[model samples]
Target: MDHQGVPSDALDPASPDPAQWPVGRLLSSAARRVERDWNAHLATWDLNHASHAVLAHLLRSPMSQRELATASSVTEQTMSRVLTRMERSGYVTRAPHDDDRRRHVITITDAGRSAFFVASDRELAASMVTRGLTPEQAEQLRRLLVVVAGERGPEDDPDLSAGSAG
Candidate 1:
């Protein structure tokens, strides 16, 4: 038993006979581990997955706070908090919309783009999640995860419907 009083490998996907574990345990544990590692990697740029997504979106074009929130699938309040941190880091700037005083447009800065590009290093990010799998197995896992994620998510979301490209 681990410190939590549960068998250490009970939720480990790499464990022998992990197939016997409940799907919820396996998925949650795996997600937690991967997120932890990914967060650590992103820390070098003082960014996280959420910030990365924001940078990605802004890279395409500047958008209002509400629009960013909607695109990010987060609430306006949540997006405000993220923007606040980003603003502090000089990664993004907020300015009043010309047409609407209540709306603030978000634009990524040069630093943000630089951080996003380096932090978006595909090889490092891919390895963090697919460390144990062969290239073919990793591809299969990505497809499977897309299916799982798409199951109950907004079907029209481009991020989901676009499908993985090699």
Candidate 2:
């Protein structure tokens, strides 16, 4: 048994060697581990995966909360809660749209931009999760994941908003 009281074999019972693991199991395990580690690191910055998504999406440009929720793959209510926290932290501001009084736009504050960039570097880097993989291998993994995730191209993904390009 290990320090956590889990049997040594149980620690990786699904596959003693990763090479022997099924693709589904391997992918699921890798994703869970990466998300756990990423979330832990993000907590140090007073953020989480969800908030990081919001900031990442906003990095492109200001957009309405509803649009942000869609782009971030979060519910509107959840996005509202996140925005409330971000606004309270001075990381974002919500203002009524000039032409659409019923609509509000979210803008990342200067502080938000700084926090996003800092956290973004750590959040987006695969190095934390792909510790043993070479750069070429990492690239190959990215390509494979894209296919498995059903992404045809960046244009098809709102999360990869083109507004950031310019």
Candidate 3:
């Protein structure tokens, strides 16, 4: 293994030869690839993964930049940059909070929701990670990933407890 703990033979990040890597490395590599592919898929819509998340969250509810960063799992600095671009693109609008002049609330525009759905449709069709998995296998994979990420399952959420499809 190299100093970075990557197998010397697997130095090529573009290669799909993770057969010999350790479990952690394999998982990380797979995640990186998935993120890259997802970003590429969103490129046509002039959106990146971070921006997409921000837009989606704003679509759900208006939020401050700090709230968006936390919800999007990004740093406030990163969210600020993303918001700037989004505002410039007219995908969102930032307005001073009525009660809090120091805080700015973000709202998704109609165009943002339209773009989000369009990109979402294409994303579902182009996602390569689940290409050949059966429904059961996909669910298993999702559960395992959720565990690895240390996140609660939908079953744990009160809103999802009413016999909603998993």
Candidate 4:
């Protein structure tokens, strides 16, 4: 309600609890909360979200910085910083491509694979987001959030990304 005793969707910045926030604010803050909690969990393995992402990609196959940046939907400059950090942590290595010395391929090290295996625990991650919800409720929440996010990329629809033979 506003000063005039009318309903309002606007958020009160002074509020300490998110339950008092607007829907949009609630959603955005909740996402940040989940990310923060997840990062804290990943810290045990000495890996954060961005570094873990690079490791996951390298686990499949070594890729040039350009390829990784594209796959991760980030810029080469950003990917370079991430690679540098991961390299110093002994999670990944960057070496010049044989065919093209201008391009450096990034590969996950043994330590990276081990950390990824442990840090990428599905149940642990899921619980961070779905805690207190029943399995069915969590599944419903997942579907609702996806729908509310509106846009769907090719990966969201397997039939579209992977052609189905008629």
Candidate 5:
């Protein structure tokens, strides 16, 4: 089948012909598109999608660097660098942990929150790329993506239940 054409169920994992799998390719292409749109949307703010993600995670509540790393799915070193840049930009503040002075709790500043709101709006607008799909089709796509990622949506993130900034 052509890349623009709908794939058949025979190409699914249930089929024996693993070589014909198109799911991976489709997802990769979609991810690239998302990244491209994200970068373009964030360019106005002089920030990248990764920085926006980190800020979004912090908007929920202050977290240790380690927690931010896990929540952002970024390495600790990467998180540190992002935090340093954010701090220098006056977007975030680091307060010494009450229990452990050696560890600092990172919190989003007013500027950070404002920037986050802008970034969130940009992201929502970019998601309109799927507006052409019907509601049911959107749900089906989401379900299929969830299945492929082997995740249970927000249910998989315990922090989601805590009602943090996000």
Candidate 6:
């Protein structure tokens, strides 16, 4: 049976041979729901999920444009376009790095921080649309997600380990 309590032939346990795994299918369906809700919520700000994610990363630390691109897993050109749009919208500012004149450092502006906080709250609320889970359950889910993403703890990233925000 599918998550909605429907007996989906495509998801029938007996029919599934080598093509699909139940866990993978469940994760995919959940991801689709998250994507749909996230995009809808972001529509109010005229931002996409990627842009919001980039801003969230910047909220944690001011980073060089290249570092931001790497952290966000976006190409340099794409990150540049996103940054340009954000700058025009007054959500972020780019200044020359103090140590390296050639590199541009990206920082979230006050407006950006406010927007990110609002978006994060909206996303958290939307996350409850599927099913309400307790805080413990949410933490467990995060751990599972980290494992799925192949990410190590903060210790793995020296940048994250450092107390400095920039």
Candidate 6 has what TM-score?
0.65
TM-score of every prediction relative to native: 0.78, 0.72, 0.75, 0.78, 0.69, 0.65
| Per-residue C-alpha lDDT of model 3 across residues 1-166, encoded as one tens digit per residue | 8755676876554556766665677888778887888888888878888999998898779999999999988899989999999888889999999999999999999988998998887537434677678877766676667656877765675444454554
Residue 80 local lDDT, model 1: 91
Worst lDDT run of 10 residues, candidate 4, spans 157-166
lDDT of candidate 1 over 1-166, digit per residue (tens): 7644678566655556757565777788789888899889999998988888999999999998889999999999999999999999999999999998988889999999999999998988889889989998898788668768877542554554565322
What lDDT is obtained when candidate 6 is compared to the true structure? 0.77
Global CA lDDT computed for model 2: 0.80
Model 2 Cα lDDT, one tens digit per residue, 1-166:
7654555555453657886555568888899898888888787777878888888888899999999999988899999999998898888899999999999999998988888788877436677777898888777677667756895755664544353355
Q: Which ten residues in a row have the lowest lDDT in candidate 1?
A: 157-166
Residue-level lDDT tens digits of model 6 in 28-95? 76788878877788767767788898888988889888888899898999999999988988888999
- Report the C-alpha lDDT of model 4 over 6-100, residue by residue, as the tens digit: 47755565589876676678888889999899999989987888888888888899999999999998999999898888898899988889998
> Candidate 3 — what's its lDDT?
0.81
| Candidate order (lDDT) | 1, 4, 3, 2, 6, 5
Looking at candidate 3, the ten consecutive residues that score lowest on lDDT are 157-166
Looking at model 6, the pairs that clash are none
Model 1 scores a TM of 0.78
- In terms of TM-score, how similar is model 4 to the real structure? 0.78
Which structure is stronger by TM-score: 4 or 6? 4
Where does candidate 2 stray beyond 4 Å? 1-21, 122-124, 151-166
Best by lDDT: 1
RMSD of 6: 9.9
Q: What is the lDDT of residue 118 in candidate 5?
A: 75
Candidate 5, overall lDDT? Answer: 0.76
Q: List per-prediction Cα lDDT, in the order shown.
A: 0.85, 0.80, 0.81, 0.84, 0.76, 0.77
